[model samples]
Target: MRPTLLAVSHGTSDATGASAIAELVALVDRALPDVDVQAAFVDVQQPDAADAVPAIEGPVVIVPLLLSSGFHVHHDLHGIAAKKTDAVVADPLGPDPRLADVLAERLAAVPGDGQPAASTSPVILAVAGSRDPRSLTDAEGMAHLLEQRLGRPIELAYLAARKPDLRTTLTAHPDAPIATYLLARGFFFDLATRLAPGRALTLPLLDNGPVPSALVDLIVDRYEAAEANVI
Candidate 1:
């Protein structure tokens, strides 16, 4: 039987946060209309892991809609994985090429006023907590992708762990600040917007907003591209 795709997030106590996650879930649902897709929060929401995991009718591919590997991705997800006797744990959405394009597109979203990208803006690839080393790789990839797409430079910043905090990263750069988020917790991630006086904007955790249809296409492509692998 075909597996069910679970788009999981850290889940927040705020009502708005839950709404945002739900919005992303809807986007993924619309993206892969043919597949059996559902949403679950590792915390702060109903249907705990025990409730969510065992109910799967077939194999489940848990696609964490998160940016980097953190406690949630590392410990929580791993715990869930240990219990998933019937499901397949897909890799966290870090380290994916489409992510770069999505982030580049997010940077492109700032109201640029028709100015040349190279002349007008620089971006901070803002990520959530970052203990894992792979976060750096993902950040670096996003930076390169943004540069290639916009003909400008972009730096990396972490909201929690790692060096170069958001403020410091912005100060290190000479160009006006723009933050492109690469994380699952959208509301928690969006705070970076306030930190930037220039223009702090974040891409939606998923969907890519105006380009929902395009993101849906990418999801289809990813599904088609999915091969036999254990993560």
Candidate 2:
């Protein structure tokens, strides 16, 4: 039998956020029709990842739907895999150039004449900040990738839990548009919109629009890589 692909996300309370993640899982499920794709969360929803892992019967590849390495990746997910036989944790989805391509596309498509053109306006890659240093590095790496894609310097800012918050970044570059680095619409996305009133804020990585093919491919790559390492 094929090893299970356990797609884990950070979880969100917002209904749209939840739906987008569900859609992402559905996309991945379709991508690998033979594999059993399962969904679980680290917080703000159920079934919790801790419970989901133990219930699975065979080899499992725990692929984080998250964007970077942080407390959940370094502690929570890895800890669960350490205790479970035939289970291996995969790298998070981000810091990849493909994701930078998505961000660039989103920035280009920002509508309304009220917002500055993506070409003219400075772009700030706004992330859901984490206290973990590793998480911060991943966020910066993503910013660099986006910078390369846009062919312009990209500023990095946090929504919470770290320095250089969104408002501060805006205060410095008042006309900058935020390229939302979040997976979906959630508290931090909401906060980003609220903080930047009347400013051009790009949609989250996963939105009401069709799931990015690049993202779907990235998840499958993570699963295949981790499953290979499972022994």
Candidate 3:
């Protein structure tokens, strides 16, 4: 049986956030190529987890497009999918090889195209914070990736409730003239939050490009493994 895909997101009360989650379904369609794809929300939205039950006649793969393996990724997604508990849940996309490529691409595609002049000093990698050790470790792992791909030292910055705050990140590369954020799911930075002001240098998240391609491969690998087990 062809495994079905149900991507559950931490749904938001805001329409825009909800729309982005919906867009992810289309993204998976492009990645998986001809597989049935469904979308669900863990909260504050319709077509909830129960809605995915009838969408698949075969095994199902539950993917969480969240950044960290926090409460939502670890517990909430599981709780909602309890009825379909047999489904296989893929790990969150963090510190994956593909993400490294995405970060490099984001930096290279900067308005100045990564010209030496664009970076007057070093680079700062601003990320959404997490209390999870896995996420923090993943953030630390980014240093190796950024170093190899970018051929420059990159420092990690926390957007909220975590260590190595933006100040620490800024301090890491004491004289960097240009700072950029490598993130998923939002427009470079979440405009809805005070975390980011409208910086002209800021660009969109890992959009349709090498990043998406890498993201898809990682997701598909997870699916292939799950499919072998009929999950």
Best by lDDT: 2
- TM-score of model 2 vs. true structure: 0.96
On TM-score, the candidate that comes out on top is 2
- Give lDDT tens digits, candidate 3, residues 85-145: 4566767666666677766666665554456654444567777667766677767776567
Question: Of models 2 and 3, which has the larger lDDT?
Answer: 2
Return the clash pairs for model 3, or none: none
Off by more than 4 A, model 3: 12-21, 30-34, 43-45, 50-58, 81-85, 112-120, 171-188, 191-202, 207-211
lDDT for 90 in candidate 3 is 69
Candidates sorted on TM-score, descending: 2, 1, 3
Q: lDDT per residue, candidate 2, 1-231, as tens digits?
A: 789999999999999999999999999999999999999999999999999999999899999999999999989999999999899999999899999999988887776523436455568889998899999889989998988888777989999899899999999988777899999999999999999989888999888799999999999999998888887
Query: How does each model score on lDDT?
Result: 0.63, 0.91, 0.60
Minimum summed lDDT over a 10-residue window in model 3 is located at: 191-200
* Cα lDDT, model 1, residue 226: 40
**76-108: candidate 1 lDDT, tens digit per residue:** 766786786665555566555566677666655
> Model 2 Cα RMSD, Å?
1.7
Using alpha carbons, what is the TM-score of model 3? 0.75
